[model samples]
Target: MTATAFTSPSLSGTEALLLDLEAERCDAMKRADFARLREILHPSLTHVHAKGQIDDYESYFRSGGTHVDYRQIDRSELKVQVLGNTALMTGRQLLVAVRKDGSGTVRIDSRVMQVWTEHEGRWRQLAFQTTPLAMSVT
Candidate 1:
């Protein structure tokens, strides 16, 4: 395994674009911007939460992003790699969110991995999974 700094000059153009798209996705989630998410997320998207919950594209989008009320997302230590038409992104994020059912606000410090693929000239996220860090790294 190799660690590359986010600002490293060795990153490929595709890697940089994926990182930007991922950032936009995080921002869209926090702001409840479904239109932007629709553009970024693939039709067969799979999202796995740090708490073991799973959501597919329809399940997540049908809820209109009301499943969680996101207060903030702090992403760091991001790395992106591109292989042919696929891109992989990994990062650490500190998220503050509350369940829509009034379950109270919770803070999550996790490591995230995302898969993005280019389809018909557009890059869309296909999969996302997060693992809670044993100790807070953020």
Candidate 2:
């Protein structure tokens, strides 16, 4: 129920800051708040979906509601590394999405890698990619 990397005694304050920013980014996505999403995303943000589709910042914003609506996102197994002005984040995400009819939800579990840049004491998402994970057979 915890991320060891973030809990490590050797992890610096910068690491914690980046981790917090990551949480904020996830919240923004679930809410689908365009303004917050725009502010958090870099102008040149690059996003790669699990199906290998690529999206730039403007494309992503413009494609809202046609498909790919996220109702909730739960992140786990997070590892973050801060390198000067950028942070790299890897984690497992459980994303719940609404059906087109709005009657039900579907879950997509994926492994995600996100890149964040620090600018003038603020963090912005620069790039992100997610890979779908096959469920384990018990």
- The candidate that wins on TM-score is 1
Among these predictions, the greatest lDDT belongs to 1
Report the C-alpha lDDT of model 1 over 12-34, residue by residue, as the tens digit: 77877777787788789988999
TM-scores of the models, in the order given: 0.85, 0.81
Tell me how many residue pairs clash in candidate 1: 0
Model 1's alpha-carbon lDDT is 0.80
After best superposition, candidate 1 residue 7: deviation in angstroms?
4.6
Score candidate 2 by TM-score against the native. Answer: 0.81
**lDDT (C-alpha, whole model) for all candidates:** 0.80, 0.76
Model 2 residue 78 lDDT score: 85
RMSD of each: 4.6, 3.9
lDDT by residue (1-138, candidate 2, tens digit) is: 223334667678877767766777777777677788888888888999767888899988866323556777788888887888988989898877775556666676899999999765688889999898843211
Q: How well does candidate 2 score on lDDT at residue 55?
A: 86
Q: Please give the range of 10 consecutive residues that has the lowest summed lDDT in model 2.
A: 1-10
